[model samples]
Target chain A: MPVALEIVSPEKLLLSRPVDMVVVPAEEGDIGVLPGHAPMIVTLRGGFASLYEGGKVTTKLFIAGGFAEITPERCTVLADEAHPAAELSKAEGQRRLAAAEQAWEAVDKMDVAARDAALAALQVARAMVDAAEAP
Target chain B: MPSLKALRIRINSVRSTQKITSAMKMVAASKLRRAQVQAEAARPYAERMERMLSELAASVAGNKAAPRLLVGTGKEDTHLIVAVTADRGLCGAFNSNVGRAVRTLVQKLEREGRKVKIFCLGRKGRDFLRRDFADRIVGDVSFAGKRRIGFADAEEIAVRITSMLNEGGFDVCTLVFNRFQSVMSQVTTEAQLIPAPPPEAAAAPEAGSAMRAMYEFEPDEETILARLLPRNLAIQIYSALLESAAGEQGARMTAMDSATRNAGDMINRLTLNYNRTRQANITKELIEIISGAEAV
Candidate 1:
């Protein structure tokens, strides 16, 4: 039996379909799931999540951060931010990377909490740049 | 017995006012459509967030280590009331209704010896409440010039409230806004924010049974909840803002429609009076002419 995979962002649902396999960027590491996986909830880090069907990659999305809820029959990713990997332009990614780097340099003036937020944003920006450059 | 010219001028002024009101009604109608679409689109994500959070919260329901956001500060002496209304005021009683609801809540809480703070979201509400509750007003946020409401605006307000919560400024938080029912009707609603209300039991049994059967937590439930509770607050605020925006537009449309009709009625009455006065003047002039001819 195929598992239903759904990728939902706060703005909208980006993807929902029955797929053979799904790979998520869990906080611990990238984890792959097949049909009938045990139910679990895990935090996501900034990275790309790929969906597989018919033993081939069907879709890839750049997820900023979010949570994943896994059920026996469904895998739902509630993302803070998400976009199709293919739609991310290299130029735009580079621009964001430069901005993140600039912000990181100036993070010293901010309070510890603000600095941490900036650091997280920088990490997400880096992941987005990498996703945009990947084939 | 006003002069014919004065009555004619009044009728013309009313006709122009009618035109303006009708135009405003059309504008509000278009705005309402967009607002309604955004509100509807936002529901799915907000509802899903609530559902998922409730499931996670169910696990840590009675845990000693649950986040302060869920379990609260263990006191209910202080209250923060977030009142949402429209920035502009041509919307009939929309702003007043929300303001009145908040006022009533504030009075009741104060009567119970509970401290209350008012966080006014829109200018109209702030102005309305200032006359009575000026000392209790803490924050006055206005989107006076914005073309439309956005999630970022809501997020900013949420962040402010969260910071206050962290500072132990308030023990309880409540949101008062108008819920969009239809173009002609809106229901004022008050929802508890801090110490987020547990998911309704009516909605829990089936999902709870399924979730309990198979769910493992990573990095423990406490950490996930610590991050999620704050986010849940933001999401709830965002949804409330969307509903308020839609309700404001709907109320404006209905108000303007009625205003246009009322103007039409006034114009008709003024025109009738002007015609009657003119006829009377013309009859008097003819009678005087005949009387003068007979005297000659």
Candidate 2:
């Protein structure tokens, strides 16, 4: 049995299909899942989710951090935002990274909540740049 | 009876108004379709997020050290209402429905001796509530001329609310918006945002109980909840914004449809009167001319 993988974003479902194997960018580390993987819930990081079918990588998605719930037969990733790696632009990613840096600096140090938000935005910006260059 | 020229002008004005209302009706109809598609597209993510949260929150509902977002500050004194509406008007009562719902909720909470604050999300809501509850409105964010309302906008609003939660702005927070039911119906809904309400147990409880799997938390429950809760809040607000936009379009379509019909009726009446008056003037002119000829 193949693993049913569903990658959903705030705007829509990006992908849903059964694949031979799937690798997710978990907070702990990159984890690979097959059909019978143990049930686990992990927060995701800003990186790529590579899905393999027939011993080849069929799809690669860049996901901004959210979380995933992995059951025995299914893996559901609720992404903050997602785009096909092929669709990303290096210049756009670079611009976002620069803006994120400025935003991070502009946030008041006394405000922990804003600081956390800026850091998260920076992480996504960095990941987008990296993904764009390599994808 | 009015002169023929005056009657003609009245008919022409009513005809122009009818054209404008009918054009607006068509525009609103097309926009409503687009908004409904957008709202539909965003549903899967929202439902998945809600279900996952419900399952996770069910486990930590009674924990003493639970995140305040999940369990509140353990008080019910202050209430914050995050109400959303359209920025533009002429959507029938779509904006006012949300405004009035917030009004009633504020009054009810105040009568119970609870301190109430408003976090108005759109201009119309602020405009409606400003008459009496201006002081109660702590913040108002309006996207008056934005090309489109996107997830980033919702995230900005969600971030502010979470920051307010951290700063002890209110003990409990409730989100009020008009939920789109159909083109002709929008239900005003109030949902508790902070102190995240537990998922309803009655919904598919049997299926859940039979196949519930014991799962391991990757970074553990508390850490995951801390991250997921805020993200969930943003998703909730995003979906609400999308649905409210759809409802606004739906309301506008219905309103414009009736306005167009009313304009048609007025034009019909004016044209009938104009034709009758023109015929009457012709008859009087012919009588005067024939009488003058006979007298001559």
Candidate 3:
């Protein structure tokens, strides 16, 4: 039995299909979902979610921070922002990394929330560059 | 009576106006279709998000540690109203309806001794409300140059609102915009935004089979809710913007269509009068020539 995997962005539903396997970047770590996986809802960090078919990764998407709910039969990913590997640009990723680094430095340390946000953005920026450069 | 030349010119002018209005009508119609399609495309994500949220919120409601976005600060003294309108006009009462509704709401809130601050999403709305409640206007944003609005724009606004919430600017927040009902009708809707309203018992499918499934939380519910609430805010703003965009295009289409039809009718009447005047003038000329010849 295949698990129904859905990836949704704020703008639109990016993907919804039955796949053999789905790997999501959960806040704790990467969670690979297969049929009969226990039901769970996890916060997603900024990374790629790879959908596998016939033992091969068919689609890889760069998802920004959001949440994902996994059930035995279905996995739903609600993302703040999602872009396909094809859409991710190394140049833009490099620029975002530099900007995120500067922002991480400039964020007020007194504001813990701001510092955390800056750190999350920096991690996401780094991930974007890695994903774009990955073969 | 106006001369035949004047009547002809009047008919020509009305005809030209008709042409322009009809063209505008067609343009608006196509634009409305595009907006509607965009709204449709965005519906699935919103529905899924709302469904998951309603379920989670049902469990979390009344909890002491609920996030502020889920359970707002227990004060109603200060109100922040977000009025969404179209940047451009000529959309009949689309802009004015929201404006008037906001004005009435502000007056009522003031009478109740609640301080109200308005955040306008369009220029037309800002202009409309600036007349009486100018002091209440806190901020205004307009997408005049952008041909299309994206989720990023809505997120930007959501971030600002979040910061404002953090600053404890207002105890309550309400969003006022025209809800797209159909091409012929747009309902002026006021929805509470700050404290996500509890899902109506009958309206929400909380009693459904899916809600009963025992789903475990990875990082616990509180942390996920904290993250989810902000994204939900952005999604709400996005959908509201999409609805207003579709409504604006619909209003423009309807207004332009009527103007086109009216211009056509005017041209028709003008042409009839011009032809009648031309025929009468010809009859007079022929009668004078015959009478002169007869006298000679």
Local error of candidate 2 at B187, Å?
Answer: 1.5
Better of 1 and 2 by lDDT: 2
TM-score of each: 0.93, 0.95, 0.95
* Regions more than 4 Å wrong, model 1: A89-116, B201-203
Model 2 vs. true fold: TM: 0.95
* Best model per lDDT: 3
What's the residue-level lDDT of B126 in candidate 2? Answer: 92
lDDT of each: 0.85, 0.87, 0.88
DockQ of every candidate structure: 0.60, 0.87, 0.79
- Model 1 clash pairs? none
- Name the regions of candidate 3 deviating beyond 4 angstroms: B201-213
| Per-residue accuracy of model 3 over B149-244 as CA lDDT, tens digit each | 899899899989988988999889999999999998999999999888886642645546465357778788887787788878888888899999
Question: What is each model's TM-score for chain A?
Answer: 0.87, 0.93, 0.94
Query: Model 1, B80-190: lDDT tens per residue?
Result: 999999899899899999999998999899999999999999999999999999999999899999987776677678889988988999999999999998888999999
How far off is model 3, as Cα RMSD?
2.0
Q: What does the TM-score come to for chain B in model 1? A: 0.97
